[model samples]
Target: MSEQTFFATAPAGVELLLAAELVELGAATAQAARGGILFRGPLELGYRACLWSRTASRVLLPLAEFPAADAEALYAGIHDLPWENHLAPDGTLSIEFNGSGPGIDHSHYGAQRVKDAIVDRFRARCGERPSIDSRQPDLRIHAHWRNGQVTVSLDLSGDSLHRRGYREATVTAPLKETLAAALLLKAGWPAIAAAGGPLIDPLCGSGTLIIEAAWMAGDHAPGLLRSHWGFSGWLGHVPALWNRLLAEADERCAVGQSRIPPLFASDHDSKAVRATLINTGRAGVADRVRVERREWATVKPPPGPPGLLIANPPYGERMGETDDVSALYIQLGERLKSHFGGWRAALFTGAPELGKRMGLRAHKTNVFYNGPLECRLLQFRVEPEFFVDRDAADRHARAAALNRAISDGADGFINRLRKNLRHLGRWAEREGVSCYRIYDADLPEYAVAIDRYEQWLHVQEYAPPSSIDPARAQQRLEQVIAVLPAVLELPPDQVVLKVRQRQKGASQYQKQAEQGRFHEVHEGPARLLVNFTDYLDTGLFLDHRLTRQLLREQATGRRFLNLFGYTGTATVHAALGGATSTTTVDLSATYLDWARRNLELNGIHGSQHQLIRADCRQWLTRTLDRYDLIFLDPPTFSNSRQLTESFDIQRDQVELLRQTLRLLAPGGVLIFSTNHRKFRLEVAALADIHLEDWSRRTLPPDFARDPKIHRCWRITQS
Candidate 1:
C-alpha cells in the first residue's frame, strides 16, 4: 500500500492526545490541529487508527484539496475528484460538509452543490447516479472548507469510534466510549495495566470506562467488536491487508487476555450494575470484569496490589447540593487515602472546585471536554502522607483555624439548636414520629433549618442576606457543621448539608441529588420513605404532622382527594384514616412514584387508591368525580412549564379554589394550605363558601417557634 496523508478527528481538547496516538501508530509525522490530527503514513495506518485509536471521532483519508471560492467552484472541485475510483455510481453516498468560506457560507448549500456535482458527473457517464442515504450510507464522504480551501476525504470510520457496539444498555449520563478511553489513557491506565496492576471504578455508570479499560488492557481492538466501518463499503479498501491486521490484533488479544489483571466495577444503583454486566458481556469482557452494586464510600480495593481508582461521579445535575457533593468528594478522597494507599486515582468532574473539596492535592490535572461541559481529570496518588488529616497538615492550618473560629453568635446558635433538638426530640418520640425539624432559624445569625431523619441529620442553610458578610456566614456555617457531630453523637458522613435558597414555583420541586438512598421513617400511623440528600425537603412535611393528623380524623368513611399531593404523605395519612376511596394528584412523576412507594410501604393498594400524575389544577377542573374530603396544599408560587398555565397562590388561588370547590361533594369539607408567609384570603370573592382559619390549630409543637410555617384554612359549602 502506498503512503497517504490521513486525518483523525477528535473532540476539542483531545487533538494533541489523538496526534500522539497516531504517531505511536507508525505515522511518519503527526501534527495536531483544531479538530483532528494530520499525519502522513501508510494507508494501513489509517485503517489501524479506525481500529485502535480511541480518542478519534473519525479517520479520514483525504482524496483531494482545492480552492472552492464559490458554489460553482465547490461543484467543480467536487466534480473533478475521481469519484469513480472511490465510490461506484450505483452505491449510495453521504456527505459531511464542514466549515465555510467565501461564497460557501452555509453547510447545507455547500453539501447540496457537492451532491449535485457528484451525481451530475456520474449521470453524464454511467447513465445513473448513486442515491444519498444519510442514516446509513454505502459510502461516507467528508468535506471541510476554510478560507476558500476545501478538502474532500473518504471517511474510513463511518460511525463515530465512540459507538463501540458494546453499550447495548446505558444508565443516565453514561460517558461516551472515546471519552472514557481518553480518561483512562490520561490516568495512566496503560502503564498500570502493563505492570499487571488492578483497576476499579467505584461509581461506574453503565461500565463504559471499565469495559474500555479492560479492552485497552487486553490488547483488544475497539473496532474488533464493531461489525461496520466506513471502509467496509469503500472501493479503496484492501481486503487482504485488512484481514491480516485483524488477525494480528486477534492474536494479540488472545495473548493479552491470558495475562489480564483484576478489573472491578461497582455502582450504588442496581440498574446501573445490571447494565454494566450486560454491557461487559456484550463487550466480551464479562469474565474479566467483576461488577457489583455497592456504595462508593464502602468500596475497598480488591485483594491485590493497589492499582487505579477512577469515577464519573454524579455532578448533582439531577439533585444535589454543593455541601452534599463536596462531602462526597471528601469521603472519596479519605477512603482512597485510608484504604487504597499507593494507588492512583482519577476523578472526572465538571466542577473542578468540588474536586478541591476532596482535601487531597492533585498530582496532575488534565483539562478535557465532556461535550460542551469543560471537565478536569484530577490525578491523585493515595500516599499516606498526602492522606493525613487536613488539620494535621501544616499548609491547611488556616482551614483548621477557620473551623475553630467560633463566630460571635455561634455559641448562641449552638445553644438554640440544642434546646430545639431536646424539645422536638421529646415531642417526636411521644408522637411516634421518626422525622421532624429540630431547628428553623432559631437563632437569626445561623439562618438554617435542621431536620433529623432517624440517624441522619439534614441541614439546610438559608441563603443569608447580602447585608451579612459571606465570609462571616460561611465561618458560622463551618462552626455549626463542626459542632453538629458532637452535639448529635453522629458521624460526619451522616450529616448531609444543603443550602436552601428561596425558590419560586417549580424550582423547589427540582431534585438536588440523585443518590436514590431512601430511609423508611414513621409519620403518625404511616410508613413513609424520606431522602435526606436527594431532595430539597424530606418526603414528609414535619410541620404538616398536625394537618395530616387532622386529615386522618376527618377522612374516616369519606372519599378523600389530595391535590398538589407532593409524595402523598397527606394521602397516606388519609388512607390509614379509613377513607373509603382515595385519589392523589401531583405533577411530578418522581413524586407520584414516591407516593406509590409510600402507599405500598403501608400496605395500601387496590382500586380504592389511585395515583394520578397530572397538574392538580387541570385534574380538578376536568374531573367529574366529587370527594367528601379534600387537601389543597398548593405551592406558594408555582410556574411549571409542564402545566397549561402558571399558578401563583396569591394571584390564582381564587380560580384554584373555585375549580376545587366544584369537585367538592355537598356537605364535604376542603382543607386549604399554603407556605406563602404573607398569603391573604379573598374572603369577599369566595362568599359562596364558609371558611375558617385553622392555621394556629394545625401548628405542631415542633414548629411553634415558626408560627408562620404554613397557613391552613377549612372551607365548606354554604
Candidate 2:
C-alpha cells in the first residue's frame, strides 16, 4: 500500500503529545496542528496508530480534498468521492462533519448533505444505497470544511480511542483514558517504570490513571482489549497485517508483564475502589496492580524506591466547596511531603489557583483539557528543599501587613459601620438576637456583608462585578478589613473573611472549611450553633429569625415538619415551642448531623423530633406521615448527586408545594420560603390552597435593609 495523509485528532493542548506518539508509532513525519496532528504515513502506519497510539482520539485516512463554499458544493465534493471503493451498496455508513463554513453553519445539516450525497451516488451506480447506522457503522466518514476548503476522510477508529473497553464500572467524572495517558507521558512515567520504580495513585477514580500506567509499563497496546474498530468492516482493511500486529502485541505484553514494577491504587470511596479493582481485572492488570480502599491521609507509599505519586483530587467543580477543596489539596501536599519524599509528584486540577495551596512548588506546569474544563498538571520534585508552607506564609504576611494603622480612605466605611453597630447592636441586645447582619454593603465602595456572631465577626465580600478593577476591589477590601478591628473594638483574629459569590447547584451546602468550630448564639429563647470560619453561612440564617419565632409562637401541641431543613433551626424552634412531634428532612448528612447537634444543644431529642437524611423531594413523595405545621425553604437550585434530576425553585415551585401540601393534615398550615429574590408565587396554579404572602410580615428588623433577601408565604388547603 502507498503512503497516505492521516490526521490524528486529540484534545486541545495535546497536539504535540499526539504528534510525538504518532511518530513513535511509525509515521514518516508528524506535524502538530490545532486540535490534532497531521502526519504522512503508509497505510500500515495508520493501522499501527489505530492499534498503538495512546494519545490520539481518532486516526483519519484522507480520501479527497476539494472546495466546499456552499451546501451544493459540499454535496458535489462528497458525491465525487469513490464511495464504491470504501463502502458497498448494502453496507451501513455514518458521517461526522466538523468546522462549518459558508452555507454550512450547522454540523447536522452539513452531515445530512454528505450522507445524502454518498447515498445518492451509491443508488445511482449500484441500484441500492447504504443505510445510516450511527451506533455501529460499517463505514464512518469524517468531513472537515474550513475557509471553503473540504477534506473528507475515512475514520479508522470508531467510538473514540479514549473508550479502551476496560471501564465496565465507573464513578462520577472518571478521567478519560487518552487524557490519562497524556498526563503519564508528560510526567515521564515510562522512564520511571523502565527504571524499576513504582507508581501510585492515592485518589484513583475508577483506576484510569493506574491502568494506563500499567499498560505503558507492560508494553501493552491500548487497543489490545478493544473488540471492535472502525476499520473492521472497511473494504481496504488488511486483516493479515492486523493479525500479525496483534500477535506481536500479545507476545510483547507477556514479556512486559514480567518486568512490570510495583503499581498501586486507592480511593477513600469504597465504590471507587471497587470500580478500580473491577477495571484493573478487566484490563488484564489485576495481578500487576494493587488496588485498595484508603483515604488520602492514610495512604502509604509502596515499599520501593520513590517513583511517581499522582492524583486528580476534587477541585470544587462537581463536589466540595472552595475551602474544603483547598484543605484537601493542603492535606495532599502535607502527605506527599511527609511520606512520599524523593518521589516525583503530579497533581491535576481544573482550578489551577488551588494548586498554590498545595505548598510544594511545581518545577514544571503543563496545560491540558479535561473535556471543556481547562486543567493544569503541576509536576513537582518531592524534596525538602522544594516544600513551602504557603498557607502559613500567606497568613503571616497578611497579618503583619494588616496590623498597621487604618487607612484614611477607610473613614467613610468606619463611620458607617459604627453607626450600624450603634443601631443594630442596641436592637440585637433588646431582642436577644446574638447573630445579625451589622453591615450589608451599606456603602457601595465596600461591597461586603459584615455579620456579628457574638464577639466574632464574619465578613463576606461580595464578588465584585467585571466592571470594577480587581486591584481596586482588593484595595477597598483591605481598607474594610483594616478598619474593622478599630471600629468593632475586637482583635483582628476575631474576624473571619470570605468571598461570597453566586453559587450554582449544591455548592452552597458544601463545607467551606473542616474547622469543626461551632459557637452558640441566642435568639428568642433558642440557642443555635454558628461557625464564623467554616461555611459560607454560619449554619444559622439570621434573616429567618422572625420566621422561626413565628413557627415557635404558633407551634403549641401541633405536629411539625421541616423540609429542606438545613441545620433544622426551624425544627429546633418548633420543638422548643412545645410541638407534639417534629421531623426534619434534608439531603446533607453533614447538615443533618448538625441538626442533631442543634436539637441536643437545645435539650430537644427523641424519635418524635426526628432527623431524616434524604432528598426532600423524594422523601415527600414516599412518606405517609402527616403534619399540622410545615416549614419548607429549599435552595434556589440543587443538582446534588443524590437527586435523579435537578430542582429549580422557579420551575418546580408549584410541584414542590403540592408535594408538601400532601403531607399537611386538614386545617394544617405550610410556611414556604425561599431566598430567591425574583421568586414569583404561582397563585393561579395553587388555586386549591389558601396562600398569603407573608414576606413582609416575616422580615426581621435586621434584614429590613434588603427587602428581597427572602420571600415567605403562609399556605393552607382551601
Candidate number achieving the greatest TM-score relative to the actual structure: 2
Model 1: residues >4 Å from true position, as ranges? 101-105, 135-138, 268-274, 292-296, 314-331, 357-359, 388-718
lDDT agreement with native, every candidate: 0.85, 0.87
TM, every model: 0.70, 0.72
lDDT of 2: 0.87
TM-score, predicted candidate 2 vs. hidden true structure: 0.72
**Index of the highest-lDDT prediction:** 2
Worst 10-residue lDDT window for candidate 2 reads 315-324
Q: Tell me the tens digit of each residue's lDDT in model 2 across 514-600.
A: 666667778778888877666788888889988999999989999999999989899999999999999999888988998998899
Clashes counted in candidate 1 amount to: 5
What's the CA error at residue 235 for candidate 1, in Å?
3.8
Model 1 clash pairs?
A: 319-511, 319-512, 319-513, 320-512, 320-513
> Candidate 2 — which residues are off by over 4 angstroms?
315-323, 396-438, 452-539, 543-567, 570-604, 607-718
TM-score result, candidate 1:
0.70
